[model samples]
Target: MNNPAPGASAPPPAPAARRTIDIVNASLKRRYAREARFRFMGAAAVFLGLLFVGVLFGDIVAKGYTAFAQTYIQVPVYFDSATLDPDGSRDPQVLANADYLGLVKASLRTLFPQVTGRAQQRALYALISAGAPQQLQTMVRQYPSVLGTTRDVWLIAGADVDMLVKGQIDRELPEADRRIKDSTLTLVDQLKTEGRIEQRFNTGFFTNGTSREPELAGIAGALAGTFYTLALTLLLSFPIGVGAALYLQEFAPKNRWTDLIEVNINNLAAVPSIVFGLLGLAVFINVFGVPRSTPLVGALVLALMTLPTIIIASRAALQSVPPSIREAALGVGASPLQTQFHHVLPLALPGIMTGAIIGMARALGESAPLLMIGMIAFIVDIPQGITDSATVLPVQIYLWADSPERGFVERTSAAILVLLGFMVVMNLAAVLLRRRFERRW
Candidate 1:
């Protein structure tokens, strides 16, 4: 209140501005703290997501890597000419139907003469694969000269013995709980010590077909079926989807009908995949009389399921082409068709292909749709053509996962690894193709 000495420095203005500055500084500090907490939470979230992905992949690899190798046992077989060719005719049919299993049993007896009781003998014989006879038949057919020789042939071990060799079976379990008894364990140990048991890279797992026996089961048939189904699905979906999208996006009248179609396509993309399966079952099978469980039927189903996705993606890709490009093309004396085909489509091709590949990848992993078409039937033969009854890889995995055998467990995981590899390859192809096409223009 004192006006004395007006030039006496205005009494320092009560330091009022300092209070406002302090309040602002405190608020800024709190804001900075909140920002740091938010950043920490985001980093933690990203790390948690990555950690979960790593654990899932690691577990799958741990369980599946063991299936790459198969166990085998060496059996000294006296290829009794009387057993292989009882009449010595060496006829193909005669050799085909011979009791090759008897020869395997006789060899097992020679290896372990101590096993006398029929039940004990059966348990000992259980060590070798049931495919041993078929193996012998194949070998004899390949080399007729080996028919009379006594040779030490390495044969696939039974699933149980393979499990025991791989340490999957617990030896400490009681006889009632264990799949194999102490007697079988002793025999397996003896074979192990004698250097007769061997583990080798399993080529058959990639080459053979479905089997009731786990040891003989492989992914070959499923791989073939998957290839055929996907090829046909691509053939059916790509052209049709692209044409439909081209018409609707570039040429079609903007009427209510086209709008309804656009809306329905968007909705179809959201439909459950199983509904497509039911449609295939009713339409492709019931109305058209297409054979069930064939790759042809599966392809039809997958093509239908993938159509909406392809249409949507294609339309988006077409729309992404700049309107200036179309204007320039038309201004340069190009027709509407010429502008779209010669300029717009080529530019949008990479996106279109990327979408197509994504749809195919989805089809590759689908089972419910194929299952509705009866692709779940246990077809043992490798399908040679599209019309042949077949089951794709996903269905094969489903079947194996449902199996009770411990051996099938590993095979199932291994099959999953294969499926994932295929998916990776497909996605990589899409990326590579996109880059390639992008550079073309």
Candidate 2:
């Protein structure tokens, strides 16, 4: 009825003209600018992070590459009756009683009979590992029948000789400044020409344990200890951590006490790892009387450290499961326990595994806690079980890093490489598992 609209109504204020710039600014311009800025910032941050990682990796590789190549000398030595025993009778006890240094000296003397100066011979013998004599004695004792025969043995040389063979030593350095003498280098060159000395991949490196001589050190013992400790940590921490998380998330009453417990768990996760070590020391070591420095103690400490992480992750995963799934199960007359276990738990598994693996990785690289628990000891033998005293990879690295030996620098870097490799593998496993088992519903 009010057809009085038209141009009536006071010449309706001339339709406000829309500004093209305003439309562009309000719709596309602002959004595009904000998105572009956000993207640029994210990309810049990622690039900077990657740059730092690349530099760090490069440094580690540069410093550690030499450790993979080791120098060895193959010496032919004659075990004379005089050295093995004055009487030609091969007594096992006599062989055991033989001096290792005398054997090494005899071997060197036989190799270079023409060079008879005692000091020169001592210098040559110095190239061999101090431990070499003990090893030879063991060999002779093991095979007393080979007492009077010539034996060919591969002996690890001193760190100086190792540095020389590895090309780390500067030939330009003065004899006084250099660890290895010019005479030793000359012998090494001669040995190389004779095919008695060469550089090769150090298989012993992975099998040997910490030694005073870097050239003789291996990570095998530490690696085994780490494996056992981590295995124990996983076995003990995972089920308990996940169980606690599930109960707290799905069954526990929502009350102040529960809230306080949750708060404490979160706080524990943020506690300094060394504090956990101290706790373990007091409880596991002192009160429980679990052997100090044993894998059991170390594993217990790591389990404590990893428990909070697992619990947090598991709770988050369980929380992420849609409530509708549980309701649906219950709607069909399923009990609460059945609904949670059969329907929700499966859905949360992938995230739980990812969290557990990440926690394990963190535990693997932890050194401070292990240090306090006495895992810093020079453990050469692989542990027989969790109760045996042990040292881990990180602690081994720490021990090597603090050594006065020059070759320890490379050993430390090599250990870092190994630790990084473990972390990478764990992360990859977590990613693969999550992708394979993650459920959308």
Model 1 weakest lDDT span, ten residues long: 1-10
lDDT at residue 133 of model 1 (Cα atoms): 94
Return the lDDT, model 2, position 28: 63
Q: Which segments of candidate 1 are over 4 A away from where they belong?
A: 1-25, 439-441
Worst-scoring 10-residue span by lDDT in model 2: 1-10
Q: For residues 1-441, could you state the per-residue lDDT of candidate 2 as single tens digits?
A: 123323343543444432433344456656888999999999999999999999999999999988988887888877777767888677777777878788787787778776668778878887787777877887887777666788888877778888877788899999999887888888877888898877789887897877888988988889989999999999999999999999999999999999999999999999999999999999999899989888889989999999999999999999999889988999999998999889998999998998899899999999999988898888888787888888999999988998988899998999899889999999999999999997786
- Each prediction's TM-score versus the true structure: 0.94, 0.89
- Residue 51 miss distance in model 2 (angstroms): 1.9
Clashing pairs in 1: none
Instruction: Give the whole-model CA lDDT for all candidates, comma-separated.
Output: 0.92, 0.86
lDDT of 1 at 196: 100
Scored by lDDT, the top model is: 1
